[model samples]
Target: MAYTAEAPAIAAGDDPMVPRIGRVRRRVRELSDVWTLTVEMEDGRPLAFAPGQFNMLTAFGVGEAAISISGDRDRADSGLIHTIRAVGPVSGALTRLGPGDVIGVRGPFGVGWPVDAAKGSDVVIVAGGLGLAPLRPLIYAVLASRKDYGRFALLFGARTPADILFRREIEQWRRRLDVEIQVTVDTSGEDWYGNVGVVTALVPQASFDPQNTIAYVCGPEVMMRFGAAALRDAGVPDTAMYLSMERNMKCGVGLCGHCQLGTAFVCRDGPVFRNDVLRPLMAVKEL
Candidate 1:
């Protein structure tokens, strides 16, 4: 249950239930079932959003699904970009859309990564599989102001070489001398030559002061749990760790308790939470 982007239900003047019209400017196939859509609003206003924020995209007759905004944070004026996997009716419909097609757009809802709090401190990002899409904005933010922080590291894991997302873009990022990028796979085929293991295995290889570092993590629940544990073992404090939690969120707002985790609503209160608030909830069984 990863809600990559969980922003507010509605902005001023926009109804929460009513979705605005948007036209797909471009669509790129990232994987066999995943597509990245670059959309622009019908009225020409860009969808202003923060890092790790999410939006509910509607597929007209099909339905709507909450997807993370996966565009460069520095280019907010380019409307919206969402990376979606065709796993369901709504999402499949989204992936089928092509250039000039119309789609429905909703809130860029919820609180985002505390990137500002991380300024002046070392920053590390841990992501797995599709989890990287939501965290990409944060990476852009970090790279946009690389001088503000120290020792930037990105540790990512995918199921296989073909399963890796944003491969070319990630390789471009790897070219930066200031960033320490480590990518791993669950299984490396004969065509591939890279580390083969879980992403946490690369955490220790990152060069950052545990006491002075801030960590942002997103992935499958099991992966996030282990990643947090690995970071904790490396001496990073609980307060310095943040995670994006996912749930079956129907409404982008807090009205629906479908996304309730304990007493907090993932759509309103957070899709992102500090480890201090998340640790206890994650440790309990059936929570």
Candidate 2:
């Protein structure tokens, strides 16, 4: 008998169900409310991910959470940087871990923002609250290769002045002549002076080819739903509009069933989906 290499499976198989465990290199606090964690394969391999993909972040004994990749893939030292909000036990625990802490990583999972589909097309990104976390990579991707995209617009909203993430970066983006940055907050203080409304309010102010524009939206479910409607009203096609979804997930792989939505799994099928594809699902709850 001769030894032979196993042929790679063509069909989806058990391997897709297995999780890839990566080690944490460092955890840098990005803001008072969020932390950026960088993790890589113990074997020191680059994590190949497209803009908008998320990974399952696991802390030993605590549990797993789905986090979006926030680093530029073109950067060599870039690993996975999940900008996490401390909202629960798992996330709270994650905030405490520092350099040399170990965490489990299962994927460069989920469908990503359609950078390729939007090539040469006008891009509009609308994000609210921590929703900006997933959209960061797409922003970086477009700016890094600015010539590849056309008229760019970013409309972001937060609950309050304090809730805004990526403040410094947003300031830098505001200075660029090629891109537009519009920010709004749900509420405002005396010192705060900017657009004060839901993110939907900013859509009407944008000037772009609805027929040629692709919109990426992420936020609270209610906000996303409303944002999609606003885009349609602005004449952006449903097919060209996309949204990043978030749900409770156990296995970053599809085996756990925690993140299942209808026939799709948010972990595997998508964190990013066309607005038209999700419209039907948005009507149903926990399907």
Candidate 3:
């Protein structure tokens, strides 16, 4: 028999890693029904992050919440922006915070969108309701590296027109020739004139090369599932579509069981996963 040699297994420690640790320097930058927080680096450094990645936020006495980074990916000096909706105890406390207030921040955690994978391909981004927060980072990433990809489209749907975040940013994207942006409401207010339908309905109007396009979706569970289905129906391959998952995250690291969704951990394995990898888990109600 001819001698054959096997390659040595690569060591995980040798891989280039994003620093897993972070610090607490709470400074509230903007607030509304949704609080836009900026956590300054204790050492006065900038945090590098991809779109769709999130952080574990801690209030003094209240518990922690997993929030996505909503700031500009290109602006490293800007720190991190967390657009938090006041839905619980910790979040309510966060809403009351303002400039110079102290809060603890850990991680720019979770798996982010596949920006590197989408490079050189057409991109279709779908976001519903609060999903915009996670999707915002990706939008900024794409725009900053605009020449790396082909045509881009963003389709967002909200419960009411008033619930939409990033209104000013959306207007700016719409004005750009490289991107196409659309907004829809499930139930329109009297002032809405553009479109009134589910976010999936708007997907059909966007141009994409099924073979060369990559799709991303973030929203409520139902919306993620349905929006992914819509993309599949529109000829996008199952492997090319990705969805962001939501779960209760306690420890930002994998030690906590709060974010386990079956065999996958939303906090560790993914906050963003390919459609085929997520299909089975997203269909289960208890997970």
Candidate 4:
């Protein structure tokens, strides 16, 4: 189920094709089919990664999947975390793992969010459903250095209230006076009483200096496409907006062309890319 690409696909003096053994430290259920697993490498080294970067995780006998390191960047020195939804064969296997189980781990791969570039500027982050997983670390990094940036806003949406990931953590964040966090669901139950719309609907209402703003967005391809347009209509330029396009990433490295998007490789050039660089490629139908 794997193929070779190039011998130098992996740098940092490690083999690109080999995976290190990782033991699950803990597992928490986030939703009906979603779980967050905390893991530590058998070698005891941390899977320290930049915000928005991802890893290739193996469920041993099943398969491997590319997942973002969904942990607080400030605490990643302790271990790695990945919040995965049981949507596919590999992911289903990943979710079935529990504490004390061993799995295969590779990477901390690809470019990360431009946290440094946002210094002294307003930051608007938008996520839909599980997209929040990859952005969690960026939120932690930004707040840990709150004074380094200007206005901050987060807008999230899910299919239903029950499908909202990190519900409690997000509620805690909404309490912070300095950061603006809003959550909306597509459908509401009898007990639901919050906004019932897409996350992009909150973009135009967000408070930020469009001329000095940097935005990060992640979600379904359709969601991200509309989300980018919403940010642009709200006055943010394409250059200042970034998107995470994590699709068809077979190899964490570029050796496998499975993640190719136009001339760029989602596993190499991105998973994160500026709107200006991605819009054209994304516009091509069925690309």
- Candidate closest to the true structure, highest lDDT: 1
- lDDT (0 to 1) per candidate: 0.88, 0.80, 0.77, 0.87
| lDDT score, candidate 3, position 125 | 94
* Candidate 4 lDDT over residue span 62-123, tens digit each: 99999998898768667889999999999999999999999998887788787788999999
Number of colliding residue pairs in each model:
11, 0, 0, 0
Could you give me the TM-score of model 2 versus the true structure?
A: 0.90
Candidate 4 TM-score, C-alpha based: 0.94
TM-score, each model?
A: 0.95, 0.90, 0.87, 0.94
User: lDDT score, residue 170, model 4?
Assistant: 89
Q: Model 1 over residues 169-282: C-alpha lDDT tens digits? A: 999999989999999999999988888999999998899999999999999989999999999999999889999889887887889788878767787877888888887665
lDDT of 1: 0.88
Candidate 3 Cα RMSD (Å): 6.3
Give residue 237's lDDT in candidate 4 (0 to 100): 96
Which of the two candidates, 3 or 4, achieves a greater TM-score against the reference?
4
Rate residue 152 of model 2 by lDDT.
97
Off by over 4 Å in 1: 1-10, 283-287
**Tens digit of per-residue lDDT, candidate 2, span 17-71:** 4555666788877767699888776757666677788776778899877788888
Q: Candidate 3, residues 211-263: lDDT per residue as tens digits? A: 89999999998898889889988899988998888888887667767888767
lDDT of 2: 0.80
Model 2 spans with C-alpha error above 4 angstroms = 1-23, 284-287
